[model samples]
Target: MVNNSRTNPSSDTISYLELLQEILNKKNNLLGFAGVGLVLGLLIVFTTPKEYQSSSFILLEPEGNVNSFGQMGTLAGLAGINISQLPTSQMALTSDIFPDVIHSRDFLIEISKEEFEFESKSGQIQTLGDYYFKQRPGNIVKKTINYIISIPGIVSGWFAKSDPLPSILAKSDEDQSDYLKLTSQELIAIGELKKRILLEQKGKLVHLNVEMPEPLIAAKVNTMVLERLIDYVTAYKVGRQQRNVEFIEQRVKETEQKFNEAQMRLASFRDSNQGLISQSARTREEQLQFEFN
Candidate 1:
């Protein structure tokens, strides 16, 4: 009789219905938070101001003779000259020069003036009476009145006390100047106005590609960059050519001088030897015969 009945342990566990209810309660709390968030988001969106934006794109290309050095070497070899010591590339496109030219201070100044026109104005007041006596009884009174009323700060401050003309003008000038400087710097730093500019070297081809945000600007900038690059390269090559021409002219002049001296020496030797044959005469004879042949 002392309780021989066995208890079923699994029956003591919480039922699925209770667990489902607890989970549903958490879900409801989460839904409430989401609803509040939605309302706040809608309020913010309706209150915010809208903004519009415009953008441009550009592309860049390589300028000038890409194979000039190689071509020059071949030409030199054909001319029977040793040009191995000559530089393969010119200095026109040096890394520092391009950016400096593009972002030059003078250029930015010009652009600023073109973009922003500034004007200054002054205000004046006129009054008539005995001109002086009606205003003040004596010189001392007149002087005090003039000091207090005619002086810039005293009269203008009292008259147009809240005028912001001076500050506005100053701010406008500063902003315009700063804008020009920043734009120029950005152009220089970004070089070619491209989305990206790429350079790579292969066995035969040296590849360059540039991309920009605006198609027309991209094309124009790309073309201009290429043109400038070419101009720099061409100028560099032409400079080298001019230097070579100078060297050749100098050499030719020296050779002519030597030839004249040799001729004079030969004449003097012939006269001293009474027209006798000499080694130099024989050499000259051989040179003439070679030229004729």
Candidate 2:
């Protein structure tokens, strides 16, 4: 009779057993890989610098008007003025704009010059940007990683025939200016500052968080950011009022000059026609006086 079985069950079972045995034989190699992975994970955990994070919660409400000017509203309208637009107006910067203000290049650059009391290094006061760079290279592993990353750049720099750029010095608070242009180093520092600082708003409250190597410095920076934000918003609110006041003052000066000119013309007309008197002229003079007054 022809064979009914296509394959031998005994041979197939033996082959499956042999496969499992091969895997078991290489068990030491698998264990070695797992051991190396465990060591690498531990190295990363211990070698990484510890970050001190501090968060500040700010509750923002609508900017209220001190004087509603309800009583003066009618008079102000008659004089072609709006009392609501005086002294203080609605904030031009809404909550949405706050993030832009916080992340602004100029804002970051200006804040970078601010001094902070770093408790890590014997309570030394250092510029924010300088302190950030100082905190780097905390461990040997990180230093080695940084060195490795810069190897290519260093090698290329050696072969380049260009003159070396002078190192950028950190600017003191007094040395900083509103119109100051950033150098390459300053730009890099500003970039790092942006990364360290984070702003988030949940519901009606805003959370400003800053991460640093020192808790004291982180807290100080958080407070400083809050203060600066308040100051900036205040300035923005008052700045518009100041500009409007200046424009009004200029208009008042012009009006006063015109009034003086009219007075001068009336005096000259009276002087020239001293003796001339008529009922119609008297009426006309009365009308002119009323208009000038």
Residue 3 of model 1, lDDT score:
71
lDDT per residue for candidate 1 within 1-293, as digits (tens), equals: 58788866666555666777797979988899999988766765664333222222223334344244465445555444455444435444544344444345443233222211111112222121111122222244344665776588755667775545698797777778545344533344333222244434443344444443234433444455445555755687678766865554565566566667767666665566566487877776556444333
Query: How many angstroms is residue 95 displaced in model 2 relative to the true structure, after the best TM-score fit?
Result: 1.9
**Tens digits of lDDT, candidate 2, 52-96:** 899988898886463444544554454456666564544467777
Which whole-number lDDT from 0 to 100 does residue 164 have in model 1?
Answer: 57
Question: Distance (Å) between predicted and true CA of 134, model 2?
Answer: 3.5
Which residue window of length 10 is worst by lDDT in model 1?
Answer: 114-123
Candidate 1 steric clashes: 11
Show model 1 residue runs off by greater than 4 Å.
Answer: 1-195, 275-293
Query: Per-residue error at 276 for model 1, in Å?
Result: 7.4
Off by over 4 Å in 2: 1-29, 64-76, 81-91, 123-125, 137-145, 163-179, 247-293
In angstroms, how far off is 128's CA in candidate 2? 3.1
Query: Deviation in angstroms for 12 in model 2?
Result: 9.2
